[model samples]
Target: MGVERYNDLFITEKQKIFISDFNNNVKYFPDNVHFTLAGEISSDPGNLGSGGGWHRDSPYTNQFKTIIYLTDVGENNGPFQYIRGSHKKSGYKLINKVLKEYDYGENRFSDDEILSIVNNIDGFKISTITGKAGDLILVNTRGLHRGAPLTEGTRKAVTTYSFRNKIPNKFYKT
Candidate 1:
């Protein structure tokens, strides 16, 4: 829907106001950039059987995402864990290398390995973003990120992404 509708879904007024500004900044994204969709992430329908663990967004250039909480978050409930500014240096290629090396033959990197990669990086800073209903996290899509496990009350949040215009994928992979 619209930002105004999303404003009401948030738990606080200040958050609503801040999101409004966020929307503006998104609208002004340079023509060279393409804005991605913004929406909610809840353990209700879409997340019914999924446990989004620590992982970064699809490795792509000129892409970014913003996450807004509509519910309280804590250690019990899955909260977002991220590596601050990781987007500034590493990208999809580098991240894959780190994962491949750390995961061995697992194909997927474990949480510890992910954190280690971020921490060991030259300018890396890892953080777990926990906040009340109104907190928001803006992430560089190229940055590493993932949802924490939900152990308590349902977790509700909205996410939006922006990206540079590029040709759509024409091939399908099985």
Candidate 2:
């Protein structure tokens, strides 16, 4: 994380707000994980439009993410969408069972489809996560989420990942 990275984000006072928290949270990870990448989605006309579908993070061990919204988000502005408490329900056994041969995001399903899988689980709630300019969302790695279309202005955000103490064997090349 450098000053230039903060400059690229269009939020007000994003550097002071996010950096302070980022520095503190960095201590939580074990030696295997390093804070990597600080940038935004480069897709042109870049609001990932509606019904973007459900997906996971990296395919190896479950991952965690911290998202800082540099702008206000609402239903029309493509608010970050996620299911609360979904992370606690997922585990390596279930991940391996469903993805025996397929990779993450490869054999993806629709939100409705995925919701059906866990609909019966207690305390499930899907939402269009709205937040203020400096609000942060802490996400579990295997957490199910996706981009919803923005009806208005661009939704600016910065996302970074966290991993377990040991990098997965498959993350290495042959």
Candidate 3:
């Protein structure tokens, strides 16, 4: 078992086109991109998935991501899961009140906590991304998401994170 990360990856022209259209803006650039191994996880609440528990990236800032699956992923291989429309609800007044004034912007939550929030939020649902090798998943990472705990086999994937503005190298190192 091993873990590794590459700061920024240079992609092909076609890949660039896909990302540009995915963001709906050509001004974005890759801030971080890397492949990692997602192994099985214990049933501990605090130690969940590759991205940890449900959370957003870059805090209040906007970000986009493309995850390319290098292997087959089924129900138990720690597929990436996301809460639909959670990004738009970040500032919804009623949902904020229902959360007891807790802001989830850049916050991580357990399944139970997220479920409670999802139950109350209208039109919110969890989407688990599963696919065969070479499949790619595009996501607005400002929304809530995480890798479901791995049960068997291995999940290998590369995540390319892009942003409208370049972030400092210092932030990427840590």
Best by lDDT: 3
Preferred candidate (TM-score higher): 2 or 3: 3
In model 2, how large is the Cα lDDT of residue 16? 46
Each candidate's root-mean-square deviation in Å? 6.2, 5.9, 4.9
Per-residue CA lDDT of model 2 for 129-171, tens digit only, reads 8988778776664666776666677666766545547544553
Instruction: Write candidate 1's Cα lDDT for 75-144 as tens digits.
Output: 6566787666655533444555665644322323466877667755655655768888767886654565
Please say which candidate is ahead in lDDT: 1 or 3.
3
Q: Candidate 3 residues 73-114, lDDT tens each?
A: 778777999877776655345446657867645366667777
Compute each candidate's TM-score over C-alphas.
0.60, 0.60, 0.73
Best by TM-score: 3
Clashes of each: 4, 1, 0
Preferred candidate (lDDT higher): 1 or 2: 2
Candidate 2: which stretches are off by over 4 Å? 1-28, 32-52, 89-107, 164-174
Candidate 2's TM-score reads 0.60
lDDT of 2: 0.56
- Model 3 TM-score is 0.73
Q: What are the lDDT scores of the predictions, listed in order?
A: 0.55, 0.56, 0.65
- For candidate 3, the clash count comes to 0
